[model samples]
Target chain A: MDIPSYQDMLAAHERIRPHIRLTPVLQSDHLNALSGARLFFKCENLQEPGAFKVRGATNAVFSLDRDRAAAGVATHSSGNHALCLSYAAGLRGIPCNVVMPHTAPEAKKDAVRRYGGTITECEPSTSSREETFARVQARTGSEFVHPYNDPRVIAGQGTCAKELIEQTGGLDIVTAPIGGGGMISGTCLTLAKLAPDTQVIAAEPEQADDAYRSFKAGQLIADDAPQTVADGLKVPLKDLTWHFVSNHVSDILTVSEQEIVDAMRLGWKYLRLVIEPSSAVPLAAILKNAERFKDKRVGVIITGGNVDLDRLPWTEGA
Target chain B: MDIPSYQDMLAAHERIRPHIRLTPVLQSDHLNALSGARLFFKCENLQEPGAFKVRGATNAVFSLDRDRAAAGVATHSSGNHALCLSYAAGLRGIPCNVVMPHTAPEAKKDAVRRYGGTITECEPSTSSREETFARVQARTGSEFVHPYNDPRVIAGQGTCAKELIEQTGGLDIVTAPIGGGGMISGTCLTLAKLAPDTQVIAAEPEQADDAYRSFKAGQLIADDAPQTVADGLKVPLKDLTWHFVSNHVSDILTVSEQEIVDAMRLGWKYLRLVIEPSSAVPLAAILKNAERFKDKRVGVIITGGNVDLDRLPWTEGA
Candidate 1:
């Protein structure tokens, strides 16, 4: 497989510019005081489909050739990717087929349907998801867009850091939650070329620390459905994402479940942003290791805001 | 009471500029689709004390001369005003004494304390508030800053609309939730001079519709103790606030408790904003009257983000 170059990311930015929002970068003096760091929150929670996934989804959907685009697109995601892919496909007047686990939150499924995606549910397992996805793609003849593994998607995700560099001028450090290493790889991709001095850090839930383990062990590590409140970070890294991670990432930090919940509440309380558990991991890392991030100009990617409101992680019995 | 002129608002803006945030104006396409109106949210929820009340509090605190400023400031509020006043006074290195009903949320009281305000708790009654405020004022020789009825405060709140008009170029209509009528009066004060053609609408909770009733009757109608999920809107209109309401407000609209809760959820879900029940009222009004707002540009003041997370209005059995 060919590695995605900086030029590919630049192209993805141009292609998805009209289709995506240049979400605001917010700063909180209160958060700064608490963390002892100057934090710039890239609020992709404000994205159209309420996550950064739309960047990749839009890039993939819009990059397709006219004839192939006519066949539509397919992806298997339990959350934001499915919703965003549907949104992007709907924007281009194409069909989007989403394969999801039956146990996935109803709110996510409803959002996918709302954005004109057809849902094909499978049993909640990796094998089931892949098998169902293959059958669905074969039956529909849709172009397969892997959530975090595709070069096009990674290039698209890289645009977020590209904007962050331009928006904040430059940063001492950049941090994002690593699920399948999509956003972190994108951050690495952009910072590697544009701002080589900037350190790229990946944060992950301790409950699902595949990326952290993988980075430390110097090899790709796969987790089999690790449970975490940060549902978006449950997936492990692929070879394409692993390549960027191993080459450019500065460090991988892990935070406990309680820390993630605390950070999520802090985002809502102090930053006045509605962010999901996955989005809070970077802040949780900062809180856990204030010494590492102290006094640094840190760009933290708020990955998404697509939690089921009825089942908020901090709620009683949740 | 002296009427607050647009000039006062201009002066207030200049006075408070260094102390307060010029919060971003956010737009949600999902909300626009749902309400059938192009909405520009003036996000005062991002203000220092997490509310637009800081605008008024800062104005009132900073406007005082050296002699009066040294004596400090005092107010009786069960909500955002106390916390914001404390914030303003802290910024100026002065003491702020707050007289709050014991029934006020512990979260609010803690916020006031956190900002260096000394809290004096009273029985949860209007009469108790007045008596306690008088005693505190006499003892401390502090200048009394009325929450919503003071001209300086009205002028301060008006700056939000001033920024909104500039931010959105010019909105066809402006909406704010009416409590003691501070924010609406501020909108009326600014729009009456700056954007006279733009209609100014006041939204109220149906359960505590004193503002709506008072508007139609052309007389101030006080509700002794009105119950509402929007705790901020329970206060009655005073002469200073009523002056602006009666003269400049185009209409008063009210929404049910359920509508307020639903709108709050919609804000959290779609706008990705952490807004309080009171802040949701303007959007709730828009939802309740789609015909009136359809296809028009509307500016909605997101008043505050000070809700108790442990007891969110929509929590199970809340």
Candidate 2:
């Protein structure tokens, strides 16, 4: 697959404009003071599918050729991507198939089904999901829509940064949690051209820091099954995402599990935003590395809100 | 104090616009499908203080004359109003003294202290609160900004509906939880003049349904210490609020505690909004009286989001 051009992001925006919400940017003076940064939250948590994955999913589902569309779309995701693709396919009246780990949050699985996606459960690991997804795609003869890594998906995800840049003024740095680097890649793909002065930074959970390790080692690294409170961020970076991360991203930061939980609670209290654990990684990083972000105008992407409300990260059992 | 005029609301908007967030509206197709109506959620829960009360609070605080502002402002509230008033006072660099029931959420108390408000605890009853507030107000010589009844406060709250009308296509009906009838009165204040055709409705928790009783009986009734999960809706309508409710509001609907909890969960799930139980009452009312809202465009006000993250209503201990 070829790298998506600047025009691809623009085209994706126009194509998906009618389908998605132009979610609002949220800010808190309390958060700014706590971290000593003027923080702008790109609340994709309020996105139509409750995540930014809809940007890529909708773009891919709609971009499919008429013949290719007939076969429907399929993917393997930790959670948001599956639900998003299903939501997009449901809009186009097409079938969707997803391979999710059996340990995936019940809320996400329920959402996938609610959006008419059929889910196949696999062991909670990257390798297992890929193996399961291959069989499902082969059996169904469906178009394979990777959760990240694809040029089309990356282009679609890039639209979020376009809106973010359009929504805010002169952002010094843009940060997002690095799961498979889909959102960070999108931020890079957009800012590298649209706002060349803006820096792209990726935050990752300490437990799932494959992207950070890869950045330091100067090679791609894949983690099979890293355990972390941020369930949606357990996966590792792919080739497409790595290309952008390696080229455009300024730095990658990792936060401890406790920091992720702390930031999640702070986001809930100060921002009063229903953000998922994975989404808190950026804020956690900012708070832990205060010197790096202090006094800078930073845009933080709240990646998703598809949390199992019954199981908050800070709760005892959870 | 006199009834707030349309010009009062317009002026309040201008005065408080800089201090508040023009919070976004949220919608969910699942919620629309469930209730069989086109629903627009005016997300005041995303307001700067995590509630719509900030609108009235800021207006009241900022509208005070120099002499009055010097002494600062004080109010008696269940939760949001106190925190919001404290927040507004903090912004204006003035002292704020609040009378809050001991039963108000811990989150709210923490927030009030965080914003530099001095909280004096009272018994968990409106009479007890007012009695304590009177002594506190007389001692501090602070301007008393009634949580809802003051014309300035009502006018300020009215701006929410104005924004709602501007943000969405024509709404056939507007609904809000009726505590002291502040928000509902504000809606009436705006829609009565701005969108004369739009019907205003009030929702209440059955455990504290004084507003519903007052609207049905054509007289104000006070419920001193009614208890419900929606802590913010425990108060009764005052004379000024009754004036608007009697003249402009078309109906008052009450929902069971279970319905409020169910709707709160649904709001969290579908809207992906961090809403308090008081915010859910409007949705609960609509869901309970589905046929009343069917085939019509309804604007539901999510009043506040000052909820204790640990004690979600659906959870066992909560």
The deviation in Å at residue B177 for candidate 2 is 0.3
Relative to the real complex, the DockQ score for model 1 comes to 0.74
lDDT of 2 at B139: 98
Considering summed lDDT, which 10 consecutive residues are worst modelled in model 1 chain B?
B309-318
Question: Which digits, one per residue and each the tens of the lDDT, describe model 1 over residues A72-172?
Answer: 99999868999999999999999999999888878789999999999999987677889999999999999999999998899999999999989999999
Superposed by TM-score, candidate 1 places the C-alpha of residue A31 at a distance from the truth, in angstroms, of 1.6
Native contacts, share recovered per candidate = 0.67, 0.60
**How many Å off is the CA of B154 in candidate 2?**
0.7
Model 2 agreement with the true structure over A1-318: per-residue lDDT tens digits: 477877899999999999999988899888999999999999998887899999999999999998999899999999999999999999999999999999999999999999999999999988898899899999999999989888888899999999999999669999999988888888898998999999998999989999999999989988889999998899989888999999999999999999999999999888878899999999999999999999999999999999998888788575
Q: For every model shown, what is its TM-score relative to the native structure?
A: 0.98, 0.98
**TM-score on 0 to 1 scale for chain A of candidate 1:** 0.98
In angstroms, how far off is A281's CA in candidate 1? Answer: 0.6
Q: lDDT of each model, Cα atoms only?
A: 0.92, 0.92
